[model samples]
Target: MWHLSRHCSGKHHFHAIALVTIHEPWGADRVGTSMSSHIEFRKLAAELDGPAFLPGEPGYDAECATYNLLTPLRPAIAVGAATVGDVRAAVRFAGDHKLAVAVRGGGHMQPYTAEGAVLITLDRLADVTVDGGRRTARVTGGARWEEVIDAASKEGLAPMSGSSTTVGAIGYVLGGGQSPIFGRPYGYASDHVTSFDIVTADGVLRTVSAGAEPELFAALRGGKGNFGVVTAMEIELFPVTSVLAGGIYFPGSATGEVLRAWRDWAATLPEQATTSVAVQRLPPVEELPEPLRGAHVVHLRYAYLGPAETGLELLAPMRAAAPALIDTIAEAPYKTAAVLHNDPVGAMPYQDRSLGLAGLPDKALDKLAELLGPGTPIPLTSVELRALGGALDRPPATPDSVPSRGLPFQFFGFAVGGDDLDELGRRLDRLFTAMRPWADPKHRRMLNFLSPEEALDPQSLREVYGAENYDRLLAVKRRFDPNTMFRMNHTLR
Candidate 1:
């Protein structure tokens, strides 16, 4: 147990009373007021059960490596927050010192770091509690989707999580999570959130939900981490133990034919099913299956929670369009659904762009073939198109900041991370231009999919949240964080 109190360390105006361990680099004899600040910092560190690493200290470098290899964090201090108390103390210290604070969970953000900010790595705080009887799961700030999946699977339940299990559950939901398999049926992961336990800028913890603090609840769901640092969230779950899910790989030779067939078939899909098509250029890595190794294949990924026979029958047209080089579609536990999308497990340089489409008309498919098909100038890893409709188009019972509900589909293209960031960004722009004809004029972009570059574009943010929701988000920001303390994530400021 920890409590915040004051102390006097030399000329320092304020300090905390707790166990202290000061690192060598931050010596007391340092010149200027920095010495006094360091003394107060040591006091704050004392309040934490875990050690806070100053620059050049052991474990400092390891704690700074967020998931995205491209983003590097250089903080004067990096704290490994082991508990809710630790997080609160770190925030309070940063507030007291006037230092910018950035929170890290799974650390999957495209450009995950904020230079010169005090980084709070939440890796050590993961603790998932599955209440199977109530069909809910309480996920801590640091818990990843994989942990939630593993725990919930024990009771034949599943959270409305995204394709990659490594993604942080709280961050994903805050950014409006889009599950490749469950999105069309479940709307979005944010809609299932029952409540959020957050520490605001003033170092006060508040439980935000529909009945209590209803306005904050609506904003928190898809507002990113602008108002506060979310420490835990209670999310509703579904009774889904297994699914008829997997990917069908076809040769590049049938790209157009197969995509066209899949598009037509997508029009007939039911709410129980969700599907996406991708043109993937798999590397000759030993980690991949033999059939997919060193192959450029057109993949049709499907997941259906209904009977296997009906699911297979619905997929027959795409299967018959061309001979599948590899078909992994079969009844399997929902826990293994990540194999369908198979997002890269290893850290590497990568860039991506996303846009919503009103419909995948012939013009759109032709553009995809031109830019992402074989022999295109861009060396893309995959150009994916996900079918969106059904529940996704309907308003959730609880209102949220998500504005992509009525879109018919969404497209994403990612390429190998390149040394020349500018050149890579320009090439990605070309892909967006090619699809602009069919792209939704509103140009809604999900926060989870926005790259660091896109996140800075005010026009992009305006289009993403729509005028009214964006205004509402700003209002909440003004109330809870007038100074914008939690501005690291995709921010309203």
Candidate 2:
């Protein structure tokens, strides 16, 4: 029996007494047990600082919700961890029950269906602390980029955040987070991580960094969730509060010209400038402004950390490449950086594919224009090519497992709609197949951009991480999680 007390405010307090029974270790197949198991589970739930849910429970579905509606999570047990102790408890419970562990932070991407696994949701643990003097931020497990951005903005500092501010900061870094605005200058977000407090398969909380447990540090940087649950991370911050950035929307008819010009012009820019162009077929939604609603356009996303004058000079070529339907390019605060990509918000059913490009020659540009440009009745909502090089092509001071280094470009395409998943999948496949000629021969790809389908193929995963990196990651997985207790994600097994 255990007594727990929680203070709602300075004035109010609540207490509860829970009777817990210690259950013997059970086989994985014995998850569906008798009524006694339910009583025992209820005791465990009462011990947690946050809520826990079982299948058919009132809040199970909501707790296991994912951003991609196509891949809904249906785990055997869902644990909402409000504290680091709760995380350890969940891990221990899963281990005792012979169940695999799956973790969700922002729930942006679910690589696999977590059926029968112990799914841990970290939304209740969100907390951000910033050290303005040291230019560092300590982001908790469930903290989003939006929170980090807001916290850092107060100190006139910013992190290398992704296009979507709603993305989980820790999960993003674990996947080698790439920032559209800061990537070219600062490299992947994982490169700047100073340390991570993680709960491994053994239910031990370990703080790994370059000096302590360097091997685990390297693996966790780009290895995704194969190792454990990261409770918190310390990341370096930049002094940038504003940037010369936004998008230039041109008529779809001009995609060919705009793409060709962007490819050539991008080659001449310095490391301070980052850019990408997307061919979009927007939906008729009220959320989108008048010009973009139900419109077909070529979006030129540009960002520069240098002087505004230099940014304007560099952008002159694309501005003159074709007649613009609407251009929102201008100087803006870093907090409004999402406007550049204008990634759609909220949950929607979608399928995506991505690949790295060795180069983007004129012929390759022409190929893309034909496949995704005007007159092709393509079903893809957006197909984008982000220029990768500069700091992104260079290695970090401390070597990590990020595999996309040296790639000149990254191509990502996705289709939105649930009514016809088969058609959406086929359309995405056709686009990738058509662009294979330009795809990187080594098959190196950005780990963060890897879709669920891409993550499913073992051979493809090996090729993406390269042979040496994958073998090294396997060794780490074996050492830490010998039982493969964390196989609910893109497993290295």
Candidate 3:
């Protein structure tokens, strides 16, 4: 019954969900605005152990904003929950009050979903634990990478986390995490998790691991966040912290030559080196160091975990590919390896899309260079290819884990923002059209990078999971979430 509206040109009618107006946990929550919606939310708030935010609250604006900066989002009640009981209460509150429910993990959600629902803010649920003897991290779903990595590194352990330590653990894992140098060691990040504390459609707190709920584990992994709300997860970690991390950026003029050269070198690289070639625009900020500042360049980010000499030797061919405009690659701590990507520290409006290809043929490389290099209207900011099939190819010790296909999950995409979002999306689509022939028909879109509206398509989900696994996920959903009470994403089916 709670209504959510923002002051951005007033609220438009949402044709999102065909919800039912009943106060039951088995059906969809009502979507139409009601006169006593606030009062109903107040009543539900009284029955919960969590703090709820109504419209006009002091912290309302900050709480509802996601990683996206383009769209203004506002939710009715932002529930700050601390315990499993609190999450259960919030779920019941949404069900009884007939309000849509949206879950927030690190507030990095790209597609805004705070329009008409009761937002479940997971920031307060932060928790990170490390078991040094076993080299594992038992982190809460709401926990950020800083907490997970900082704590794990203290015990000489590290997990397959993302470049930006600010990203959420659960969100990154479920969407398939691409580590700093994943291809050489761990193929993908999702294969590291051992267990998940899941809240399914029926609002039940279920513990899913390798032996139990195997199908669910597989589905939840890389299937995207469709089946349930993950509360906590136990993921494997590695020993040591120091790594040879950094990048070498080539000038815009050598974009084609550098990309082709780096591609060939990476193909012959050993498992100890993790590297990707990125096409980036140097920002007009003094924060950027010399050489790389204020210039568009093709950059090669690298992480060699084995040893420094071996690392230098492995990249010799790339060093000879093209004279570097700015080379920062060197031996550095793995904890700071994130600096290689240098993702923005603050939140900005961003739109992401990804394509997984088998190999970058000569023609595909030409088209990529055409769209990414320079003078392209879309400004395809970054083109990253993280090699797959390292230790990540090995089967995990848990059930319902996201499977790591023993093949290169080549990722090529860009982050677009500013006032020309519509133009950027259209331009990227056209560019992708030119490159689609190079894409493997069996390739699946990475949920973390796909457009959210198109992300939930069943066909896309099936593509990501393959038909057999997708059918298996449907059967698992039937058993744990038959009513589809947890209808928050595109991966759910």
Candidate 4:
């Protein structure tokens, strides 16, 4: 049985207390070996400052929970890491037992089932510290964007946080985080990272930075979780405390006109303005406001880091394209920026796909309208086209391997349901296939947007990173994880 509790008087703020009397040994072919392995695992458990549970133990399922219910985690053992030492111990235990290491933070992306890997839960290690003088935030393990935003906002600053505040800050940055609001102006969240405290496959914790381990740093910036489990990260923050941003929902009947207007107007906007438009089929849920509940609409998300008047003036063209079902765009504090995208919270089954577009000409816009507009019998929940460029196209002062930099737009679509995952997958495939003509010729994509379905295709993965970056990533993989212990994610192998 497991007993969890929170306390403030300790090196770690939280802890998971486990008291197991029964020994449920795994892979017990013989009595002697089973007993020995059980004792060894007990020793490992004793070494951790947090709780450790076997496959059938209580809290294991909760500890291994994932945001995407379609891909559930069934690990050999689950460790609730309360401290950096607990993370180190978990990694070392996995290495000693010849088990792959899997990490869960905010539980957003789970590319694999992790059938027998050692899963480390980082929920206990969440802590954020803001440095007003240096204009940086030190985000500890499992710290969500909400926590970072809350902390940084107190200092009159903000991090390059993504649309969803529930997303793990470290994992997002590791995947080359593309912020809906800050992306075009400030670049990716990974570009602003100063350093990472990660435990590699060898169970050694290393502080990786551009100046320290340059190659490893570059690889980790956009490499996802292929290298190791990150314990903490220090990222640069901006001084702006407020922005003019929010969503405008237009009836789906106006999808074509709104799409064209947004496409044309987005092209004329300055770097201070960032925008995206989505065709959404909202569910009839009580949580949503009445107008948007069960509504088929075109959502135009806008964010401008300039004066409210200028922002309003710039957004006038698209706003006038069609009558709005609901318009929530207004000047607001940066802490409330998540309202712009209003990404769904809580766990749900979903299949998603993303594509990079070199350009979105009139023909492409028409095709999008046909695919996602109300006229068609589309089953997908939402399909979005985010404008990319400006600062996103420029290289950071400290170079990193964040792909999708020069792409004009990113196309993303998802269908939410568990009743028929195969059908949902087919729908996504059909949508992308229809838009193939405008797809980025080189197949360069936003690393963060690469879905589990796309990650499964080895050739597509190679093209997403490009030949040179993929080759370098492979070399780094061989150097750091020679035995391929970190194979749970979109592996380089």
Best by lDDT: 2
What local lDDT does model 3 show for residue 166?
78
TM-score of each: 0.90, 0.93, 0.88, 0.92
lDDT by residue for model 3 over 1-493, one digit each (tens)?
0011111222222222222222324333345543155777677567666577777897777667665555445666777777777777777665555555667887464324555566777777889989999899898857988788789889987778787777888888887777875545766677777888988766688898767777788778776666767888998888868777888878877888987887787778777777777777756566666676667888788888887888888888888888888677887666677557776656555455667676788898888788777776656656676665566456654444343355465665655456566665676677767767867577655556665545545566667667776777778777876655555555455
Candidate 2 lDDT, 118-142, residue by residue in tens: 8898889999999999999999978
**Over the stretch 240-350, how does candidate 4's per-residue lDDT look in tens digits?**
898999989999988899999998999999998889989988887766778877888999999998799999999999878999988888888897765578887767777
Q: List the residue pairs that clash in candidate 3.
A: 69-349, 209-399, 210-398, 210-399, 217-400, 217-401, 218-400, 218-401, 221-402, 456-490
lDDT of 1 at 462: 76
Looking at model 3, residue 175 earns an lDDT score of 76
Overall lDDT per candidate, in order of appearance: 0.76, 0.82, 0.68, 0.81
Give all candidate RMSDs, comma-separated: 9.2, 8.8, 5.4, 7.6
lDDT score, candidate 3: 0.68
Task: Note the clash tally of each candidate.
Answer: 1, 0, 10, 0
Name the 10 consecutive residues with the lowest summed lDDT in model 2: 12-21
TM-score for predicted model 4 compared with the true structure: 0.92
Off by over 4 Å in 4: 1-36, 107-111
TM-score of structure candidate 2: 0.93
Candidate 2: Cα lDDT at 456: 49
